[model samples]
Target chain A: MALRFALLAALYEEPLTGYDLTLKFKTRLANVWNASHQQIYKELGKLHEEGLVSVEDIPQQGKPDKRLYRINETGEAALSDWVNTAHNRPPTRDPLLVKLFAGGLLDRDKLAHELADTRQIWREQLAYYRSVEAQYFTSRAEMPAHFRFQHLALRRGILGMESNLQWLGEVEAMLADLAAGV
Target chain B: MALRFALLAALYEEPLTGYDLTLKFKTRLANVWNASHQQIYKELGKLHEEGLVSVEDIPQQGKPDKRLYRINETGEAALSDWVNTAHNRPPTRDPLLVKLFAGGLLDRDKLAHELADTRQIWREQLAYYRSVEAQYFTSRAEMPAHFRFQHLALRRGILGMESNLQWLGEVEAMLADLAAGV
Candidate 1:
């Protein structure tokens, strides 16, 4: 549902093929949202059927003809309405907490190990966010003004991962204390 | 799947009723994960049927009998294995980016409003994290040694929320700039 409107908004800027939108999503909005190629293609069809977007075919010599999508006026109106009026809280469900709460039943050693593994995962994620930040911020002035908002999202990702890592360390320490009967 | 193991591990500490598990989750592992009463009951039943968790009835005078759940040895082993194993990368999906990408198709004013609304949501989340941190840190010394790990998770939540709020500010600024055509 949100994807439909987002796609329309992107098209409003310039006509793009489904493939182009996917790439844009990875670079520009990678921190906030993601979608599989299959999902993107599916939404494109829905947007066209609803007349929110129009499809154009460009003839090509050897390669497959590209199906370009542009937001129609109606599509623009819909995207605007959604932006202004739509509910803003994104849906979130995390399975890790569920496991942790239930951790009491497992051996203390086992829980400790899981916490360690979770910590490592967060470390990797933190590194990735930092690398991406460096890539974007190196030429900050050359980037689009709107990119500042995306950068903020990236910062959140980094902090979130770092916090998890910190939490994992605490968990590990606690487990060790419990094992030693301290 | 993670829920089952979390619950099993938690039971390893001490037998708990479903309600107790829910409260512990909120206080102990709230940063890493979250679950509702409905999910708790559902998972409990599944665990019981699978012979992973055993339920003992505690008679109460006025209230219903407390069904205390304990992890069986088999469940313990499973939880242990899970903790030691590698976890798959978290699946990524965000609706906000999609809307931003599609912004060109929508009404400019409407898009601006949406960005504003998103900023407000992030602010609220940041406030919540701060409150949680304040409450936890106030009695830091009294916390169990293992709680050190839990504190790290709490910090992560705090930082993550702060970063999100910061991002929203940048986004809001960009939307304003776009509105002003500057």
Candidate 2:
């Protein structure tokens, strides 16, 4: 899975058990790549067999044995090799885009309602991004070394929602004109 | 293929041979939902099998028989059903975002170079979207009744690119700060 590389990158920071990896993947990597715990467990097994990661067995008192995975030199090299190259924007498979493109099929009233609903959704998303920024952008001294990178991802999310909200306004105006036969 | 629904929507415009569908898909749907001619042809076959579309075999003089496909009533109902509901934003799988999240993995110079390259790419893309707008937004009267819908999709592309360009600016400045040990 493409998530393997992301998991490798996470482990590069420090050794973490499967649960920690899943949590990190949720908060830290949630904006870029999202993976389920089941998927992460599966990839950890593969990384172990591939020798890209080393597992540490930590015996816990009265608890199940904890297995932590760390990225080895091989995994570090692999991640760097993958990161050195340029990456392109992915092709559009967005269902909203598809629906908008097929808008002629919908009744004008129905279409307007759809656009209005989407606008509300984007507005809520913008607020969510702001909340995220507020929580994380407390101070630079407390910032992690990778904070800039992670912050960029959050900023991207904010910018995207802002732009979408603007377009939705324009769309609503256009819908008004269409409904009025303007 | 999900592309089949897109194809069905395209056919909803009017009956067209596979060739016409490809051209329209490229020019009109390229930004929102891109599909190659080969994929379109494959979907058309599936659509026919599912009774979503009806094909007309047109006789040609000393050449291959032209096949035209049109969306049947079932297809129209399905398309409407699909379009009326809300569509969730697609999950992010961007490699650049992934890279940014793992910024400590790269040398500062290398990361700066990658960001610069992406900035250049997005700049070029902004120009491309402008060209596409000039081509389509010439005269509203010439547009189909669905023109408003199609036009909204194009505007969405322009806005997204603009937002990305702005975010890239912030990122490049941040990279410079990091490089200078700020």
Candidate 3:
């Protein structure tokens, strides 16, 4: 739903094709929400049917005709109304945590392997966050004011990854102690 | 699905009632997974119907009957299979980030207020992580071997929270800069 609102908001700024919205979502909104190409296409059709967005057909010489979307007045009103309202708390369901909670039922070796694997995955995430941080700090000056808001979200992502990396290190130490019964 | 496995894993150690599972989940597996009573009850019923768990009723004179659950051989096999196989990547979605992405559509002051609120929330989360960290470290000597695995997960939670806090700080700074148009 937030993704829909974001797409509408972007189109409100200026008419954009589905492909354009996808790119914008990645660079500007990837930290907050993600939408696959299929989802984007589906939502565009839904929004058009709902009269919240209007589609314009742009001729392309050899390729498929681009469907440019612009927010309708109804869409603008809906967006405005949504912006004023507080969103509900995000729902969460994590499978890995469940596995950990029941770890006592498994052999120590198997549990250790899972934790080690998780730590490695988080390490990779930390590296990705650092890369994102570097990318933003180096190139953020050229972005628009609204985009700067998106950058704030990216900063959060980077920090979140860093925290996970640090925690993973401490956990490794504890796991080693357990393995040795120390 | 993971929750079911977690419960089965817990029952694999020894039969436990739903209440006991909740308490154990909060402390031992809080980092890895979380489940409400409603969810646990629902899943327990499903597991029973599937013949993956057996529940024995322990009558209490004045209190509710204790429904102690133990994992059946089938359940154990399921858990073993899950551990050996590769799992899908963890899902990641943050609505706050989505809001920030479409922030240009919102009034500037409104966006700033949301950012401030988000920062405060992360600060509270960091404090909670700190408390958890302190508890884990203080009890390190007396904790069980399996607990060491759980502690590793707890550390991950702490680091994830800390990283979010740090990101909040950077975001606050960026918002301030944007407000100042610098």
Candidate 4:
């Protein structure tokens, strides 16, 4: 259901074909609400069925016509209503945390290796988010309302990755000390 | 599948009745991996069928028998194998982020209010984690290997909540400034 609103929000920005919408969702919104390409296409079909979005077929010279999706008035109203609705924070479910909780049952070296691997992954994510910040959120004060909100959302991603990285570092250090018999 | 391992980990600490296991899961493991009582009971049945866990029935004087679940050797081996397996970081999905992404469609004050509400929730969580810390993790240096791992797990929860609170504060301030025409 939230994916419905997220798709509407993406369409609210501008109309795109199913292909373009999936690309845009991956680039911008996947960090917040992860959805597959199939999900996006399926939801687009539903939104059209519900009369919340309209589709237009643009003929191609040598290929199948592309279906362009546009947000209708009903879609706009739904998106607006959803934006105002209160939302609760969802549950946290991290496999790494589970492993850490049971770490004593396994070798400390193995756990440390997992931590290192996770740290590397988060570092790469932080770098990607930083590139996004540099590309789009460089001038916050001059950004329009929509861009400002995008900036805020991006900041959340960046902060979350940074926090994970920091916690992984501290955990790694503590494991090292414990291994040293200190 | 991960929930299976989480349950095995919890039982590795001590044999617990179904009701007692559910309570312990809510108090300790829910932060890392949330599961419903029904799911836990269902998984326990499966684990027992698979010979990963053994269930013992202790008869009470005036009540029904209490079924206590203990991790079997097979369960220990399975959990150890899982702990050694390489796991990827999961994708994030925050409804608040989606709303913030489309926040320009709604009133800024509403977004701010949501941020405030989320901040309060995280603040309360941080306080709760702190209390857990004080109760169990007060002497990190003297903690055994298992306790040290538990401490590390708790630290991840604490750090995650604190980071969320900090990000919410920054986002709220940014929204205030944007509303003030700054």
Q: Which stretches of candidate 4 lie over 4 Å from their true place?
A: A60-65, B59-65
Shift in Å, residue A126, candidate 4? 0.9
Residue-level lDDT tens digits of model 4 in B67-91: 8999999999999999888787777
RMSD of each predicted structure: 5.3, 3.3, 3.9, 2.1
Give the native contact fraction of candidate 2.
0.70
Q: Per-residue lDDT of A23-141 in model 2, one digit per residue for the tens?
A: 98766566678788999999999999999999999999998899999999999899888876766667666677777778777676766777778778778767877888888875757
Please report, as a residue range, the 10-residue window in candidate 3 chain A with the lowest summed lDDT: A97-106
Q: Determine the backbone clash count of candidate 4.
A: 0
CAPRI-style grade of the A/B interface in model 3: acceptable
Could you say which candidate leads in lDDT? 4
Separate DockQ for every predicted complex: 0.30, 0.63, 0.46, 0.73
**Residue A112, candidate 2: C-alpha displacement in angstroms:** 5.0
Candidate 1, which CAPRI tier? acceptable
lDDT score of residue A80 within candidate 2: 86
TM-score of 1: 0.68
Q: lDDT tens string, model 4, A1-182?
A: 89898888878888888888778777777578877789888988999999999999999999889999999999999889888988877877778878878867767777777877887878887888899999888964577878878888888888888888888878888888887887
Candidate 3 lDDT, tens digit per residue, A19-45? 998887655555566777788889999
| Residue B126 of model 2, lDDT score | 74
Best-first order by TM-score: 4, 2, 3, 1
TM-score of 4: 0.93
TM-score of 3: 0.79
Per-residue accuracy of model 3 over B1-182 as CA lDDT, tens digit each? 57788777667777888898888666555556667888888898899999999899999999999998888889888877775554655646676666665666667677667767766765775577678768665663587656655555566666665666666677667767777778
lDDT of all predictions:
0.67, 0.80, 0.71, 0.84
State residue B34's C-alpha deviation in candidate 2, in Å: 3.1
